[model samples]
Target chain A: MTERKREILASSQSVLKEKGYAATSVRDIAKALEMEPASLYSHFKNKEDILKITCFDMADKFELAVREVNDIYFNAEEKLRLAIKLHVEILTQNLDSAIIFIRDWRNLTGTALEQFLTKRNAYEKGFREIVQTGIDEGVFNETDKKFAALTILSSVNWIVEWYKVDGKLNAEQIADKLSNFILSGLKKEMI
Target chain B: MTERKREILASSQSVLKEKGYAATSVRDIAKALEMEPASLYSHFKNKEDILKITCFDMADKFELAVREVNDIYFNAEEKLRLAIKLHVEILTQNLDSAIIFIRDWRNLTGTALEQFLTKRNAYEKGFREIVQTGIDEGVFNETDKKFAALTILSSVNWIVEWYKVDGKLNAEQIADKLSNFILSGLKKEMI
Candidate 1:
């Protein structure tokens, strides 16, 4: 919550992304932050602890985005499009945390790992609920909801791998385009 | 590739998927194959070498699948759909190699790594050409070809992460569902 803690978490995410969770150390985070390893210890107990905080922070962000979308009184089709836009915004906006969250969350062990998976499944379930709503209302195609949800999430999750600071499309445009692409797949009737 | 060489590659890919590229050692692969480390070395100089072959072998599978689809003279939409099915079939049918190909390809280095990137670009280009053909023929939406291609590829690629042999959808059903989702994104209009 503090300014310095945010910096440490940000640096940890970056170092974890660059060196990978297995290869990264608190010292690497300290080096990237230009701080003492002891200072990092004061903030986080260990590398796994650092990863735990980072991973949970990412989960919180994803959940928060989903919650924000839920506040809007829109149809399932509009809700999914807006929720996807929010999800992609977080990923492209905070690129480092996005990459580390997707790639290195596996490195978290014990309760941290278990909780992360639980939260992730819940987050994906939110998407699935939307797809089910669409299917029930006949706004979207009546196909396998799990398959549809996974397809949408996978396509968006992959943006972190290919997104660039100066790509052909900005984050908003890319989100719009991606939302269009995904929504087309779910639309009841093709245009 | 010789029978024994193919066996080595197959075991290497499975071990790499299980233990990851960093943790899996030559001894691990040898243990998996019930072969001595020296015998493994006669096939691959080291773990990285084994990884190189496995990655390229997966790439070859991808290229071979695309080639088979190219033999058909369907419209771009149908061509792209069949190509996606073949691609997913290769991934789900050869599950371990598909996971390794997506996850562990980052661990490759040197000329093998460079050549792999080149080949990957060419493989993507193959897909792009199909999309372009569809766009030219007025069968597909005139969107950013790269973004559309990347969307289709990413959705299919992530299947290696969630697809199961005994899951709700069989390989053929999954391939069909995914192809339908993706083609819906590209088609000019509903039939």
Candidate 2:
């Protein structure tokens, strides 16, 4: 992305996080960027175009983080822990992007909506593979991989709903706790 | 509540859900009820008053549903399952109320916000008890009860963020799948 486009996306994110999707408008985005509405259209066709770009950017960042974690080729247990930690870390750092992804991504219209959904599903596929690897390696118990993925994703993805960047518990702590809880359940422990 | 007060609260909900709390005014409520704005003030002190009443009404109904589950005195496992089901059921049956609670409850000011938080915490107390009971009975492994409660609540609360009454998964199915996954994690079993 060009520096100007990046600046517009960041400002759009600031507005979206504070005012929310339905309440935000192209004029609001322009106001935040200190540009005329028509000027914004030059960098992005419209507000929806800006939103789609923002969503895709966030998704790409998340995917890259997960890929970096995957590159370690650690044991399934370690890989899962790192994956969880990286997920939380990126989300905590880019809370504005996370908020926009969680709240406003669904509002993308027509082709934009489909493209966002595709990227989201691709993002989820990484998590599914982690769970599958764990089970396949005999480190995790056998279960319905699809449901397992959904359950774990449900917990992790919803972090943005209540997670506070300045909360007492930091992202690493939460990731550790969540990883322990999930791993405990997945292992064949006789607790 | 008096009949007129109840009517006012009901009308306020529809308008709030449709137009949002920021946009919906007393005049909008009056229009919905086909009465003068002056008549609404007789039942509600102001717009915030109506919002408080509506939120409390939603919390009260949710509490009732949860309390009914508690009265059954199921084992902690069963209680946890029933609690999840009841929460989903209420969120589904009362989508408008749920939306109001999710979106507009923050508009509550001063004492109303405190009261709503107290009532909302009371609603969560049931789940905390279920988790504690499971731990005490050795059905669920002892983890951080508070964190576990928050995790479970976070997952369930986000359901409203995505659930559609007419969606592919009905409330019961979503409840069952979610409850099963959570309980699976909590229960002393292999995943």
Candidate 3:
């Protein structure tokens, strides 16, 4: 992408983060970029198109983070911890992208919508597979894998809503707490 | 409230739900109610006042639901389940109010913001007390009580994002599943 294109996407993301997706308009983006409304047309088709791109880009980054974390760990417990850390780190660093992913993915329609749903489900399935691995290897409890996945994902996803820029809690602290809580729930104890 | 005042608030809520709080202007509410903008001033000082009333109404209903549920349950487990059930039921039934509570609470300034925060935090504290009681009674495992409270709240709170009007899972079903998962985490092993 050209510098201008990146700038437009970045500005659009900031606007979306501050005002949300539905409130954002082409005129708003153009005003933020200090360009005529038509200038945005050259880079992206419309507001919907920009949201679609942002959602897709966020999905890609999330998937890449999962893959990178998986490569670094072989144990199921360590993999789970690292995956949560990677997700929280990436999300905290690029909060705009995370907000777009959570808030605007539903705004997408037609083929763009389909593409996002597909990628999102695949990403969720990746997490589910890891949980299943932990369960089968006796590292995690034998529970409903899908529900566990959803519960974990929900907790992680809502972090973007409450994460503070200047707060004392870092991504690693959150990751450690989350991973510990989840593992404790899954670990078998002596009767 | 007078009949006209009630109608105005209801219309404001509907408009705010369809078009978020940030985007819903005073004119939009006036148009939705088929009244002149000047007439709305008789009921509300401005858009922020409408939001303040709406948020207060939402917080009241939420607290009522929690209190009603807590009154009927003697055990921590049952109280927790009832609390989750009522929270979801109230939210799903009045998605508009829920949306306003979730999204526009921050738009409130000054005394209104402080009042809403106080009520919201107090409401949350009710749940935290229930969790702490469970831990003291040896029904729940040792964990950060406040953190667990937030984790459970976040998991239940995000249901509004994925829940559907015609989806296979109704509000009751979703609430049941969530309550069950949360209870499972808190329940002591019988072995």
Best by lDDT: 1
What DockQ, on C-alphas, does every prediction get?
0.54, 0.26, 0.32
> What clash count goes with each model?
0, 0, 0
Candidate 1: docking tier: medium
Best-to-worst ranking by TM-score: 1, 3, 2
Docking class of 2: acceptable
Clashes (candidate 1): 0
Tens-digit per-residue lDDT, A1-191, candidate 1: 78988888887887778757765666787888898888887777777887787778888999888876766778997899888888988888888888878877877778888999999998988888888878887889888788788889999999888898888778788788888998887787833
Candidate numbers, best lDDT first, in rank order: 1, 3, 2
TM-scores for the candidates: 0.91, 0.72, 0.76
Worst window of 10 by summed lDDT in candidate 1 chain B = B18-27
Q: Per-residue lDDT of B87-167 in model 3, one digit per residue for the tens? A: 888788877778778876767889999999999987888788788878888898777777778888888877766666777
Where model 3 places Cα greater than 4 Å from the true spot, the runs are A25-44, A67-75, A187-190, B1-56, B68-78, B95-100, B103-115, B134-146, B164-176, B183-191
lDDT of 3: 0.80
Q: Per-prediction TM-score, chain A only?
A: 0.92, 0.88, 0.93
Query: In model 2, what are the clashing residue pairs, if there are any?
Result: none
